[model samples]
Target chain A: MTVTCPDLSVEIAGLHLQNPVMSASGTFGYGVEYEPYLDLSQLGAIVTKAVTLEPREGNPQPRVRETPAGMLNAIGLQNPGAEVFIDDKLPALQRFGVPVIVNISGRSVEEFARLAEMLSIDGVDALEVNISCPNVQEEGMTFGVDCDMTGRLTEAVCAATDLPVIVKLSPNVTDITVIARAAEQAGADALSLINTLLGMSIDVERRLPHLGNVTGGLSGPAVRPVAVRMIYEVARAVDLPLIGMGGVMNAGDALELILAGATGVAVGTANFVEPAAMHQVIDGIAAYCRRHDVARIADLVGAVAADQA
Target chain B: MPRATAILRHREEVVSGHYLLTLDCPEVAKAAQPGQFVHLRIGDGTDPLLRRPFSILLAQPETGEVQILVRTVGRGTGIIATHDEGVAYDLLGPLGNGWEAPAGGEDVVLVAGGIGVAPLIFFADGLRLMERQPYVRSIFGAANQEALVCWTEFAARCDEFTAVTEDGSAGETGLVTDVLAPELERDRPQHVYACGPDGMLAAVARICRDAGVPCYVSMEQWMGCGVGACLGCAVPASAGGYVRVCADGPVFDATEIDWERMKRR
Candidate 1:
């Protein structure tokens, strides 16, 4: 009976999840667009694309390019603004019964706080703060790369809302764990890492960048090892629970992160390859638990052994 | 909207570097419309990560078959170009909205450039079975006659077809717009449909705009999810901001797009 029924439930930052797999922000478009391909109610959670205070047109075409074992996208956070997101996109997702984790971006700490206050509605479960956008007040410095800014931004957002705040850390930084620790110390409820690695591709023949934005974020299998390393480091440095994501494709890849310290794993680029990938990851996690005699998936979080022998 | 593992019924070399793949997917074929596409997982590997989008060239629901034209221009297409028959493909389809055809009788002109002809062929085939067929004339262009994929089959399906090659290797030694200009003057076509490189589409859009004819263009973009979820395939819209080529359309009114401002990579 234990082998046949292994519990896949997980609790991260005070929210109960059916499983560990959630849609990575920017990759999953508000959860409703994928309705034709997969069942939404079965997902662990739905993380939306980045939402801003005002409507954004986003980067020009071409926005994506298929690279080795991965793909690069410079979507530039195109969204219908916060009001449209809550009024239009959120209502459709309310019926899915899955938690709606809204990923947000802002140019200033005030904007971040304002967004948090406005989005603290009945249906919203949490806030995944995307610290990737440039800080207009800081002379174009990225908030995630600056330790002091990250902490201040995290504190501002946490203070503005009652919902759990998950600060998504960027991998482009020299020390991601430092940023992760900064968020934890600043009252952040959770930390999600690593965001897509900054990478670029060139069209040698035409002497032009493949993406219109020139450099784009790299995601898929190519970034899994880096994601695991970052999660491992952040897990050790910070007391907050971690939502690990970056190139997560299947259960095994997800488990690798869970073992590294991620309580919840978000599937990003893989959703583009297979729309129903999160379901497979969830199913595979169950099979993995049953096979290993692990009764519940939460037991596997940060389960990696220090010594292999 | 089914995620199907479609099997390859057959593969044919339409021309050098261009191949036709017939897939056995009942759900996709049964629901397939002209100008819509299928996203194909290239291989059982991640090196070429994103699924490649190929516009449907033909759909035979009775046979549960759909076909795509693959030009070996990149690693993804190269993989499919050499794939053997009977191999199963991880597929997602009848994805995105199909072309909105003319309601009934209208003077419609289809302008295709090279493999951009694929979806137009599907459109032509679809028009034949419609209750009222439009007066269709097509103009196909290629770098050269040898590079041209299909104009004969397109000619058979339409009321009239014109072929153009840059070097005069086949028909008119000029662009599709060269023929379209005189054709537009000959009878002021009611509607124009086009697909090809961005430059060609832009030129065609200009002609249609000048002639005050409604034009529909099937755009090609670097796509992530063929579904609208990713919002990766963005094209500039005239109404301000961007529209997704994958969702808002692989097909859109020429006027809906702000072509002058678009920087298509």
Candidate 2:
């Protein structure tokens, strides 16, 4: 007897995917670093690290510190700038045969637009505008904190490139729905939430901050609940497709976000725990679909009962 | 590059708060090199979610075994220290740039302080496996006698081994640099390799610079992805910009590091 494979294909905006599992930006580096561990083509999409108009050296040492169930990091959006990334890194990513979503962070709306235009090349499939990097002092704040700024930034980025624009939202705000709605109204093709929550840790013995930056954005299992809540809220509030991520370690966690209304799911901190975690998640989702007798994996998106909601 | 499940073969408290864990992983051992490290998943679930990075202390491919020296510093290491023989650990390695083996017949000095001895021990072992043996001097220092680790194993292999403590408990009474200074002035070993705390490494780098001896030092930083993807382990380079320790060189030329900025971290 032959077993039928469930359909796992998903489309966000106009971008097609073999599956609905993509590696979150910053977690999976340029899609080439994990090549030795897993098949790159297996992923739905590969989101490159936060690229900038100018080369950024990032924060100083002790940039990461493990917390109870998660970790805090203030990498400050380190990248080789768009020109070098296109020349040096993009070729390696193109070899994978997977959709490449470039995540870009800018110090201003013009910078974001400039990056979007520069990265709108033949190989890039989408642009993920990172307006929520808490590690950077000046830039992320101006664009992400206020609703008008978020909308304006999203609008400028969308206008710069013909590629699908995905705005990544930060959870360190009063109401993430406001920013989500703003991005949606500004013609964002899709939305990814939530970027790491702002947090900090201290070394009591030395009376010093744990991270060199003193504070960092927290990621991992500890922030899963917050991610799900925001995704659920933003999905209901906005009409755009959603890409959800936060502490996604396995297939079960990926499904949790999909049920909450994410068209696709991303694996972040789990990449560090198991380099093959995205593959496992992709496989696990297929296995779940087969067990549940669901013909299409897309049926699982936002499948939670309205009464339960 | 192979991710494999390693079976625990042996575990013992090599030093007071440090553990020596041996895993029977043929794939990792076969691919392992000196100064490269393994990222180990500590807990079964996501509570202690991230994998901890540990330097490969010994990799014996023939025996299909690799050893790591773990210090019980926090929750991750604390949980890892409790595992017994027969437990399986999901390991991703051998990651990062390991030591570049020195040319044969060159005078070499290996300096280590506290747990910094982890990677240097593997480097020394690799030298032994080579066709020619160089003039080797190993210097180890700790807070006290009990804090010193792997002295016996290192002593058995090197031509001259010196263990020092701040309290004058065992071999000598001063810092490891005290011994490293005169050795640099007199013989001036062709190459100096070191691993330890930032202060110790900085001192070693300074001494090597003054003596005009090329030095390579292994650095440690809180890392996210042991692979270079997550730029979490950024170290300021002496020349200009920052370099990711995981990708660039956990082992770097002593002169490349910005010792002053590194101390701030």
Candidate 3:
């Protein structure tokens, strides 16, 4: 039987996702938090938080603060480390019946390799090397801003893990596509761009940085345009599949990512605003297909040619 | 687990500064408790990503109406206030553990600071409806007289109500804690309930600690997922580490909270 609503299913880095709407790392916990709020089975995949070589308690107080149309967070990647994730979090994620993409961050190149090696053990669908995190004291923005380092690190993780590797790019770079191209050259199976743009909010009265860490990554509707522009640019520069996300709040926004050449979209800051927003976006995509007389969801991917009106 | 549709039924601009939004989500209203809250969707698109959180001011199940008192302080709240009535507003709710009202015939002390009074309003009403002859006292504070929103309703219901303004425009001059200082010393309330800005709650928690009385204070946090998952809305607890404000509480026992760390935040 032919699928009625154009096939929205997308395959990224060997993971056969039924759709392209994955939950962004750090937004959706290992896959349990939304169980009480929404059905996790509907999502393309659930990306766990940035897993480290060892457990981290994260940053100090005032980890988060609200900004204009966005928010600044310096969580410092407080995760249960890679072992705990593989041992504890992965089993729980398996029950969701969706692919699980493990997001790994590191303080050094070796740490990234170690995390990748550990995550390669079963249960994970892909490895999203998070070179986008801006909280740590070292190696946060370093690898992302320099295309050469990004390429070097992506290759390290690719060599460490047997699973498909998707390098998450940072938006803080001067040219995001430069790093995207580098990751592709380094053997990354796919790319997830762009991570939160570097930002900070000041408490005028206190005359101090609003977030615990002086600066934080900015996310939400405020950064969508920047993310989309970067994703479109990166899409043309690299041939690998793209996972586009930044302040995506609806199905139309998800569609925009696909048209801009993203093979999938991750729902991030949108979860903070509304828990069930991703499911709604999924339904909206189906309705959009019917309205546009489209047969398959995959047909819309990269369909907006440069000559289009 | 209810795949319930939360439609924006009515959006009333209550007072110039706050919007009294009503969501027609029957499951949420039916399942809602006294101190629970809902996460609201912002903007028609994802540009202003993240859901804004608001405590449940009132949930009328008979009418399928759940109300949220939103103060337009930022982009999310501003977007929520401007949402047109009849449009669909996405919401995930009736989440978080609520305040535990006195069982019966117990003197109650209610304290609110600025917009903090929003969530506790329903709790006070619930106490009065129980007909427990509660020696109710409400100590509220605001920057000035104009910032106070529900003083009239609080006064009519509370057995003894005291309003404190920073500039001495309304009631007591110093702070809500100053007004409550004497009450704890003289009246010695059996149980206390409080909600307000963090600074005020910190002071209230200290007072409760000094008096050796039990207190429940509702907390506010900028959350990602209002459910227990994201751990974005965690507040440090005296027990250790952090507690999810959306799941473990918006209402936490005063003594159980880590006031020292929260003050720093």
Candidate 4:
């Protein structure tokens, strides 16, 4: 049977993507690491692991642990710093057909701006702000938890570069929409929700935490419900385009986020389980559109039924 | 490396808790080298969550098969030990750097504790094939005789073999290092390779250090992506920062590791 292909293309923050499937930050190393196992050109975007102003040693050993249908990680944002990343890592990614979204974290507002400016070179399509890092100036208050700080950081990053800025929200907050609106008002080009949920695991036999850092961010199939709920709420609350991700393992999970009002869906921890998972998700998304007779994948955004009948 | 769904060609319980699983995967078998490992998904589902890394025990390219040794240390290994034959299990392999073989006219010694003997057996079998290779000696240790994995393989391939156990179930009732220290003085084997528990590897690294013998060790850890992307399987390097066990070296020179820090774990 000769079936015509459905258009899986999407546009986030003015950068046109080949599809609606992307690699979540922190799960995909720097895009080049998974070259042997996956074809990078198949992805909508490649969100790299978080990079900081300087190289980070990360947490001590035992940085990860497997839970029920999920996993926890406390990698401490270990990276080769910004300058080294631009020189060493970013060069390899330039050859791919996919758009590159560099994820960044910082100790203060200026650090985030400097990183945004330094990465304003060619091949970098956009910036995904990782505001999960502690704001040392505020005595270690995470920016995403406070609306004011989130707004301030967003404005600073937006002003630093002409590249479209995407603010990634943490799910640990009481009300994620409050922070989402703040980023929108501060001139963020787009928003991505949610980062991993704050969680912990302990070993009863050893009487100690499973991760050396004591706590970690949980991601996998377990976080899908929370992501769907958050994306549903934020999509209604703000007009800015939303990129949804949390425990997305297959095309069905990605569609759930899209139907809930997400412009794009990013696969996180599944990259660790199966490197080719993103491609499967992309193929499935195309197949899904064909089966349902939908032409453009973007038409499914916020398509969830609001009727309780 | 291609992530292929390989059929479980055979499964056998070598002893009380140890298992030998042979998978029919031509790509992985042909590409695999001793000391490199594979990240295997326990099933087609997600309840188990992460893929487990196993040392490549044997890879027969001609037969289109690869063998992995597992000791039921926990729930993951327990699940893999009972895996049904003839079912396809997702596997990514021929990963990490394997050991480097010594040139001709060199005497070498091998050390294995528990299931760490898996890769050493493959290394020894390769050495036996080289016509120019000379004398080879090996030491096997575990809690008892029954836990001594691949003892028969080492005994048959090496010129000389010694077995030691904490409970005195095998040839000697002492540490493998105890035999190794004096053996270093007596024979002075030029190259050494050891794999075992963290404490045992630390001791072996130390003894080999004092005797002026160059030794290589294979490390194990709870890994996320065995492809070096996760940065989860990190071991402290003596040089300063952390090195990935999956990418840097599952097989590393003994001196490159910070043995003092590893023992703290």
Angstrom error of the Cα, residue B232, model 4: value is 0.7
TM-score, candidate 1, is: 0.97
State residue A202's C-alpha deviation in candidate 4, in Å.
Answer: 1.8
Tens-place lDDT digits, model 1, residues A1-309? 567888787887889988888999988898877888889899899899888998988877888888889888888888999999989988898998988899989888899999999999999999999986421223113898989999999999999999999999988888888888888899999999888888889999999999888888888999999999999999899898999998888999999999999999999999998888999999999989988999988898998995683
Model 3 misplaced regions, further than 4 Å: A1-5, A60-71, A203-209, A283-303, A307-309, B1-26, B42-50, B63-67, B72-89, B131-135, B263-265
TM-score of each: 0.97, 0.97, 0.87, 0.96
Cα lDDT of model 3 by residue, A52-105, tens digit: 998877765567776666778777787777778778778988887888898989
Q: Write the per-residue lDDT of candidate 1 for residues B103-206, one digit (tens) a residue.
A: 88887999999999999999999888888898999999998987779777788899988899999999999899899988999999889999999999999999
The residue-by-residue lDDT of candidate 3 on B1-265, one tens digit each, is 7335678888766577777777898898888888888776665554455666788877777888887788888666766777787778666677789987787887878998887777777777677788666778888899989778767866777888888999999898989899887889897889989988888889988988899888889998767667766666777778767777888898999888888877454
**Which of the two, 1 or 3, has more lDDT?**
1
Compare candidates 1 and 3 on DockQ and give the better one: 1
Pick by DockQ: which candidate is best? 1
Task: For each candidate, report its DockQ versus the true two-chain complex.
Answer: 0.86, 0.79, 0.37, 0.69
Which of candidates 1 and 4 is the stronger one according to DockQ? Answer: 1
C-alpha displacement of B179 in model 2, angstroms? 1.4
Q: What would the per-residue lDDT of candidate 2 be over residues A39-90, giving only the tens digit for each residue?
A: 9988899999989998988888789988978999998888889999999999
Clashing pairs in 4: A220-A247
TM-score of 3: 0.87
True contacts kept of 1: 0.94
* lDDT string, candidate 4, B69-146, tens digits: 988877788888778899787888878999988886689989998889999988888888887975789999988999
Q: Which ten residues in a row have the lowest lDDT in candidate 3 chain B?
A: B41-50
Poorly placed runs, candidate 1 (over 4 Å): A133-141
